[model samples]
Target chain A: MVSATPTRERVLAILDTVKDPEIPVISVVELGVVRDVECGPDGVTVVITPTYSGCPAMKAMEDDIIAALDAEGIGGARVRTVFAPAWTTDWIPDGAREKLRAWGIAPPGAAHDDPPVQLRRAGRVRCPFCGAGDTTLRSEFGSTACKATHYCNSCAQPFEEFKAI
Target chain B: MSNRFFEYLLRLGDDRLVLGHRLSEWCGHGPILEEDIAMANIALDLIGQANLLLLKAASVENAGRDADALAYLRDAREYRNALIAELPRGDFAFTIARQFLFSAWALRQWEALASCRDADLAGIAARAVKESRYHVRHSAEWLVRLGDGTEESHARAQDALDELWRYTGELFLTDAIERELAHEGLAADPSAFRSAWQKDVDDVVARATLRLPAVEHWQQGGRTGLHTEHLGRMLAEMQVLPRTYPGARW
Candidate 1:
């Protein structure tokens, strides 16, 4: 008899339905938090990477993954977190940036290659609200560790920028 | 699984836990909203690191105790954090100076640990190094600003340095556990990072136009589980809910 076990693709498809608790607009897969899905004889393992080392949303994301898997009748699904080759904003899926912008959160800009001094000078982060480049950083940390708070001089609107780490 | 390794892990984990708690005290009390958010972010980072380190320590001990048990249940004397970490959070200048000193030392230690033989530790260290770099930059920048900003700010920053300087010697003091782990390639020698820490700290202080306090008496003993009176109060507040409602879930 052939086993009716869920395939890795099916598991991933199920995960696509799981939204990040903090950012409901993005699924874990689109955010690159879902690192891998492996199926084995004994069980299925879902590997994840946290966007920030201190992200409080990681536990919620993990629980959501497990729940999503179980809802699909996928038993013995385990979640594993890895830290090496640490998660980067670059891992964010293509077109997700535009989605993030549409959702009112500014997408992360390119990773900085400059020294700390140069990096401290506010980079041109186009405002999601006003599409203006005259935004200034109010704080390196925002409401979450993964974001930076910025204010657009043009629109006079305060926004959170997903910091590239 | 070695006792020495277990002790070493506790030392590192406890330092992060205590300092994280101290920083968390500034949650809603920051002088400004931006600083408030930054302090909370750094606190969260430190707490997250403590969770990982304590979890690793539990696994190494092979004991039934887990991270929560190790963190929230431990008595004051059972903690192995540095005395500097347990000291009360003073004014904003004091907090910034304390963070600058600790982050400077921790950044060097993490850099060395990233190359250690233990893969798990190296991975943790590698991840922590990135965060610590940002932490050091933040604290150092604050130091420069506070030192050069105004007469009052400069005096306050210098006073904070003087008061906190004595406790810093404990960071470089090595014991048998550290020596054994260092010899085994599982841990980095604390003494090895001292000069680097000193240079980095001195550079920041110099740029801030602040002078380092003269070395007089050094305070120690937190690594051996002897902390000041402050840690007990802090832990009492920190562990109350966990102890009161065992198995409480958020």
Candidate 2:
């Protein structure tokens, strides 16, 4: 009977084990993709927000959530995606930034406190591998929709920087 | 009535879908490796936005159609994307010019939509405004570089701008449906964006050392489901898979 109705905390713990498909080092929880987890008489509904609208990984993440709950014997689970608050790099936990940097993908720079007009100018991005500030934007778009390509002059490495948006 | 709102959503979604498809064509064919990745990334964003918008449209229609069904099953005549989106990806200059013009206008459209009365649409717009901001900056920078670069690049950029100017009018056309939505604060009046878009485009063109051509005749009709021949061919390629194999999933 306990297995049939898992607590929200238990569901969350199971979700913490679900890693982002693209960046395997961080769990979706750490990435802040899991927006909400509501336990109701009907079922458990997990609300997720996509990092980017077109991110191919969203479908995979949704499936993983359902699978993880099912594996834990927590049936009647549903995954819902919401875009109201919208996902931002700011949602990434403090520790996850270091994890992403150590994994070689430069985490996003500081959030856009400045107006949008100033965003046209490239922000200072430190090299994830070398910790150097001398980097130039190679392209606004990168290997993934959530990233931008940058060339680190200090280490002579072309790296992907998770875009601040 | 929800009919106008449904139509409005389709207009927004179809534009992004068709434009995304066009940009996706540059996946491995970009002039530079960086450009290849950049174009693909933008394509992903546009397509993603299209998915969300179409899903909202489907819900509004309440016709039991999903985003995939609307995106993959729609015929060419049924599509409401602007003619500018369907124009062939000519050269790098042409593609960049088209993107610049579209992004400039889209940035403002999304900004207005962000504050509209519809919460769901506002949410989508709020998120898209950020993406569109980046897109405009990227394309604007490229416009400057290509226009002010080599002699050949300058001429190509000029020529592309001239050819594409005629289609820009369609973007700002406000039909009865849009006017009604705008009056109700449900949708933005595209005509109101003209001055801002012009200023934005003019600033970029001046910095790029390119001239805005004197467009004599303006082409319009994509909003009403009338499209150029180009859309038919593009749809043939885009819709082939779903049309051939019904209910095929990845």
Question: TM-score for each prediction?
Answer: 0.94, 0.96
RMSD of 1: 2.1
Tell me, per candidate, how large a share of the native contacts it keeps: 0.42, 0.63
lDDT of 1 by residue, A88-132 (tens): 788786588888899888998776533422115445688999899
For residue A73, give model 2's deviation from the true position in Å.
Answer: 1.9
Each model's lDDT:
0.87, 0.89
The alpha-carbon interface RMSD of model 1 comes to: 2.4
Could you tell me which residue pairs clash in candidate 1? none
User: Which lDDT tens digits does candidate 1 get at residues B1-250?
Assistant: 3788889999999999999999999999999999999999999999999998999999999989999999999999999999999999999999999999998888888889888887878878877876787788788889999998899999999999999999999999998778888998988898886777888888889989999988779999998888899999999999999999999997
Which CAPRI quality tier does the interface of model 2 achieve? medium
Model 1 misplaced stretches (Cα beyond 4 Å)? A1-3, A112-122
User: Once all C-alphas are superposed, what RMSD does model 2 give against the true structure?
Assistant: 1.6
